[model samples]
Target chain A: MMKDEFLKKLRSHLVKIPEKEKQEILSDYVEHFQHGFHKGRTEEEMVRTLGDPRKIARELIADYHLERAQENQSFVSLFRATFTFLGLGFFNLVFMLGPLIIVLSVIFSMYVTSLILLITPLFAIEALLMESSLLEFLLRLLTSLIGAGVGLLLGMGTVRFSRTFFGWFIRYLKSNLNIIKGVNKHA
Target chain B: MNVQFKKGVLTLCVLVLTLKKDRYGYELVDHISEKFLIAEGTIYPILRRLTKDGYFTTYLSESKEGPPRKYYQLTEAGKLYAEELIGEWETFNKGVDQLIKEGLDHDEG
Candidate 1:
């Protein structure tokens, strides 16, 4: 196999990578061929030594997505990365999906709880305004103020937790990826 | 050895070799493959990962025979990482050696 054919096969397999990075990756293979030829080796010899282009492209694409997921910290990129790993057969869908669902629920519940707490004060105020007795209005106003204060505190706590969780979650996913890199094909 | 085991050892070889001097993709592939058989194409992904992690920095330098080659140098961060990995590898290697020796003796006995 010559340089062009080898690189074409690799490029086809690695369609998911960004253009710049994809080119950068291909250039490495091209340089590898040039260097091999300079060393008095044939293109076929170099190609054989390098193994299958499809497998090489798969490893690189999985890794590229993993980095994108870690850097962006967005759901789309992270999910894309996970899906790529799933294709590589390194990560099980149950393992990845289970934790993802669990974490999402925790975060979703936190936000919902904060929202409910915040609105409780408004509900109290409306009820107080309709109260015929001034004493009843006072009690409701006091209780409502307490609810609002607690709600504010809870909102701030959730924000802090989310930030910390974001940092921890990225770190967790990255460690998972690093381990995957050493995964044997048969395993 | 399993491919994962080979890859871990290859990663160590790459880091240890680069610590001595910078190396290009093909050069490192040849140097490491001389000691351990591997699919030479796989090294590139590891190189890309270490570079992305900021442990190694890459630059292109002209070769006398052809197009310029991408060379990887160990950064300050990479040096630290290499040291830690080597340390862990040493301890692990020693333990493996001990276990294998003991197992062999047991088999002989």
Candidate 2:
């Protein structure tokens, strides 16, 4: 294939990356082609040795998303990074899917528990209107207040914990992707 | 021959290549591919990543034959990184060699 066709295919396959980065990535190939041409190599030879443009784009896209995930540590970004890295090959599915489900389930359960604790005070409001004795009412309110306070603390801790956990998770995914990419002979 | 194992080594090779002097993208690819038989395109991403990771710094310089090319130079951190990887490679190499010798002796016995 011609250099232009090869690069155009690569550029089309790249998604979710900034235009500036897209240009920068393409320029590397442009420079490579120029160097090869100067060395008396044909464009076809260059393209063949470079392997598939689609495979190359997969690597770049995975790297870009992984870097973004590392930078922001947001659930959305980390999810995107993980999904993109998983796209590299099937081995990732075996390695990442089980851990991913367990991690998300653990986080989800923590959030639900915190929410349940936080709403205990609302339940105490119903208890207050049920004509309970003043002492009983006061005790119920005091316990509910304590529950809400603990909930608030737990909520904050979960947020902090999830952010740090996501950071480490992204790093693991990055190294995992690196290992898979190495095993990818076509890449 | 094991691509999975070679992947980490590829990073080491790139780091070691730039240790003595700065080299351009194509020049580095050419040198390593001559030895490793890798997909020529993959090396570019590795170069970008190593540079991003602060192991290398890049600059654009003109060439006599064509447009200017980007050159990668090792940082102090890069040198230290190369040293660490080299040390690991030596230990790993010795371990593998000893295992091979033991396996061969066992088969003969």
Candidate 3:
């Protein structure tokens, strides 16, 4: 392939990237071609040496999404990065989805449990009001209030754990990506 | 001969190359390709990544040949990173050498 053809293919594959960044990426290849020409090489020769444009674009896109996920730390970018890896191959589906499903379920259950515990006082309100004995009413209210306090603490703990888990999940994804990239094969 | 293995080392090579002097994308590719084969175009993504990571700062310089060139200079953090990688590489290299020697001797025996 000549330089123009190669760059054209690369540009098409890079539709996901923003215009400015995409242009910058293409310019790098254009500069590469110029360098090759200066070294007395043909465009076809340069293309052959550069390997496949598709693979190059894949790496660029993956890197871009990964960076975005890391920076924004939003669910949208994280899911986008995860799906991008999933698109890379079938193996990623198992690796990416397994932990994702497991962690999310665990977090969901924790939140549910905490919410139930927090609402215990509401559930006990009628029982406390109907009790004619003051001591029994006080006992019920005390137990209910304790449950609510524990619920609050558990909710706070879950939030902290989720934040830490978020950081950890990102790191895990990064290291997983490095392994797939084969950059960490020796390390 | 593994592509991934070469890629992992390519980052180290790029770091070490720019340790002494700033180098352009093509120049870096040329120097490394002379030692081992690589898809020349792949180096650009690596360059882009390292630059984005802030390990290297780049500037455009006018070349005598065609158009201006983008030259990569190692940042202070890049130097520290390169040194750390070099250390890990040396230890890893030693372990691999030992394993190879032992395997060869066992085969001969």
lDDT of 3 by residue, B3-24 (tens): 4445557778899999999999
Against the true structure, what is each candidate's TM-score? 0.83, 0.85, 0.80
lDDT of 2 by residue, B51-88 (tens): 88788999999877676889999999889978977776
lDDT of 1 at A41: 89
Clashing pairs in 2: none
lDDT of 3 by residue, A117-142 (tens): 89988856777667557777777778
Q: After superposition, how far is residue A18 of candidate 1 from its true place, in Å?
A: 1.3
Clashes of each: 0, 0, 1
User: Cα miss at A146, model 1 (Å)?
Assistant: 4.0
Reference-based lDDT, residue A11, model 3: 94
Best by lDDT: 2
By TM-score, rank the candidates, best first.
Answer: 2, 1, 3
| Ten-residue region with minimum lDDT total, candidate 3 chain A | A176-185
Residue A70 error, candidate 3, Å = 0.8
Angstrom error of the Cα, residue B35, model 3: value is 0.8
Tens digit of per-residue lDDT, candidate 1, span A1-187: 8767888999999977888999888888888887888789888878888988988888787677667766665666666766765665654444767888787678778778777877776776687578557777777778877877787888898878766766675666554543423232222
Positional deviation of residue A148's Cα in model 2 after best superposition, in angstroms: 1.3
Q: Scored by CA lDDT, what does every candidate get?
A: 0.76, 0.80, 0.79
Error at B13, model 1, angstroms: 1.7
